[model samples]
Target: MSAALQIGLVLFPKVTQLDFTGPLQVFSSVPGAKVHLIWKRIEPVASDSVLTLTPTTTFADCPQLDVICVPGGFGTDDMVNDAEMLDFLRQQAKAAKYVTSVCTGSLVLGAAGLLKGYRATTHWSAMDMLAPYGATPAKTRVCVDRNRITGGGVTAGIDFALTLVSILVDRPTAEMIQLRLEYNPVPPFNSGSPDTAPPEILALMQERIAPARQRRSEANGRAAARLGGDVAAG
Candidate 1:
């Protein structure tokens, strides 16, 4: 029998619930897939929403995984310069078959020095922040550059997971999972992307998120500087 596919998702405080759960739902459908919610400690971690997730394994206890994924939210601000978290990701990426992230989770990967020279994507508001980490940012729902795969935003996690499923298993298997989940999305409005949203609405959103974006940008700058310093020190 083939070995079970081990997959781990890093769970951190204030993570966007959908960014983790959307991919979780899709990955759980794969036969013989062992999915783990991983954190520094095996405790309850709160999401940006009301949802609270419990880690199945602590970083110290988790087995080497075939896939390692990070899900993002405002919590990424805390992680971008976190030495322990970045070290853990660096350790895992050494042997993991794929290193992936959803939303601002790419920022965490970038902070870990993993996204250097790779093309990646993140939530639209944070797209410009990728370059400081030596990453080429793509404004797409899902992006794959070599072994790094990234999702654009919270809802994009489903698309990202399904895409990864196709690569890990097969297109037919991913299709079957999509069918079972009734994954067809037909929103009541065509305002999902900045390009599709009405100009005024887009402007309003940009204004509303400006403060958070600025804060994250500052964090990214510090993280990138730290990574550069580490490289120089080595």
Candidate 2:
């Protein structure tokens, strides 16, 4: 490889590790690629589960990235109003070749003012939140409107990463990487999406997530106000 492609994945408490790890594996597998786990400080960050990961770079020393990926989970509700974190994302996205997110990470991107006027997707539950950021919400597995690429839900990270690999390199390279990862999908249950899931299950999930959704709404309202967007719709 003639030149290295620098990739950064933002790390925070309660983030879904798979969202970052899935893409990290794909990018790191590419020759001449430098993948970074980034945070305010270089320390071990715990995920939503017991899984933990250490940041490879701090905000101060991190170099310009070719790709910036923001993953989401329970922490995102807190992060949307975190000034320092949002500023970090805004600054990095300004210089990155591609600004990306997986799941509810799009909300973080929105809070940073990066998703303004971009068509982006997020978890199905929070897809409508994009409106407050002046963004058009796209409800898809993976949505790529210009350089602002976003993925829907948690497991969609792998699919989004593979799609991104094709953009970063070529279709054949992405294909090879997928094959190496043995990325064939054969889910035992066909109820991954809200449309496919049984009504009872969907209702249960919504009930469980309602509190977090309320938190997210409040955070987005603040973020919208900060970014000079219409708070009413947020």
Q: Estimate each model's TM-score.
A: 0.98, 0.95
Model 1 residue 56 lDDT?
97
**Predicted candidate 1 versus true structure: per-residue lDDT over 28-91, tens digit per residue:** 9999999999999978999998889899999899899999999999999999988889999999
Candidates in order have lDDT scores of: 0.94, 0.90
lDDT of 2 by residue, 1-234 (tens): 578999989999999988888888888888789998899898889899999889999988889998999999989988988888888887888889999999999999998889888999999989888898888998899999999899999889988998998998889999999999999999999789999999999999999989989988888888878787434446
Candidate 2 displacement at residue 111 in angstroms: 0.5
Compared with the true structure, model 2 gives a TM-score of 0.95
Indicate the worst ten consecutive residues by lDDT in candidate 2: 225-234
Off by over 4 Å in 2: 229-234
TM-score of 1: 0.98
Q: What would you estimate as the lDDT of candidate 2?
A: 0.90
